[model samples]
Target: MSHSAEHGRVRAGYNAVAEDYQKQIGGELAHKAVDRALLGVVVEAARGGLVADLGCGPGHVAGWLAKQGASVVGIDLSPGMVEIARREHPAAEFREGDLLRLPAADGEFAAAVALYSVIHLEPGELRPAFAEMRRVLRPSGTLLVSFHLGTEVRRLDEWWGHPVAIDFHFLESERVAALLAEAGFTVEARLEREGLPEEAATRRGYLLARRDAG
Candidate 1:
């Protein structure tokens, strides 16, 4: 499917479950110490500059970043998701945008976190999405990405008892590193951990990359 079409489906799916998602998954950091540690590293790397929390659903991650002293904005494809994020994170900014074509100026951000946000993109579209992210990041900007680790696509027909359409694509860590490299980033670190029982029962991958200063 085209990226636009996929984004539409993803938007609809998230809109259908925005409230439940926030209630169930918003405070997930409380349970995942590993994720919190990784996020701390990401925030420190940003060096107190603007950061983009792409696919920031309900602004949980953005709120965390704010507490860590980084100026952050939350962006998601679903208007409903953005609305909830605004309501929940009254101090932060939330905008509706697509990952393939972010609504921001080039080199507009110093760091970005796409935590499980790109899982909805088809494998072939990953590179372009990463390129868009890189384009919006300043030199030496840090990027931290998290996603399911595997080689398969899982489609959800319903979420929170609401009917919807979306696909979650799992990818290998090595493959993701290669794609980041292809998008003009240098992979700086890679972390993998077994999923919590609350999350999907699969391994997860986290990669930290940086834009070359030169």
Candidate 2:
């Protein structure tokens, strides 16, 4: 499928399951101590500047960051998800936007987070997506991205009893880090851990990088 077509499927799929996903995953952070800690690092790095939660689903992470005093904005591809996020977390702003073409000005954010967001992008889209993230961030801005670790493309024809089409692409930490570097980010840290028992049985990788100052 073309990129636009694939994106449409993802958008439609998430829209179909937005409310259900919110109900099931909104409170997930409460049980993820490591995730919370990593987010905390982003909040600190923001230093009172704007923080963009790229591909934010349901705004739970953005709300959490807002409560920590970070100026937060949540961006998602699905309008349904954006609406639910706005309703559930009035403290932060939410907008419907594509990650490949973010709806923000250059150097608009001091930090950006894309937790499990890049998994939707096709292999060839990784570098461009990372470059777009870099374009929106100020020099030296922090970026934190997480995704499942492996080499598999998992397609779901149905999710949560909703008929939809979407593909989740697992990735390797080394490969992702190289893409980030090529997109003008300097890798600062990397973490790999087994999924929590209640979560999908897969390893997760997290990379923290900063936009090149030059």
Q: Estimate each model's TM-score.
A: 0.97, 0.99
Which residue segments of model 2 deviate by more than 4 Å?
none
What are the clashing pairs of model 1? none
Residue-level lDDT tens digits of model 2 in 1-214: 8999999999999999999999999999999999999999999999999999999989999999999999999999999999999999999999899999999999999999999999999999999999999999999999999999999999999999999989999999999999999999999999999999879999999999999987
User: Considering only N, C-alpha and C atoms within 3 Å, which residue pairs clash in candidate 2?
Assistant: none
Worst 10 residues of 1 by lDDT: 1-10
Off by over 4 Å in 1: none
Query: Each candidate's lDDT (Cα)?
Result: 0.91, 0.97
Worst 10 residues of 2 by lDDT: 193-202
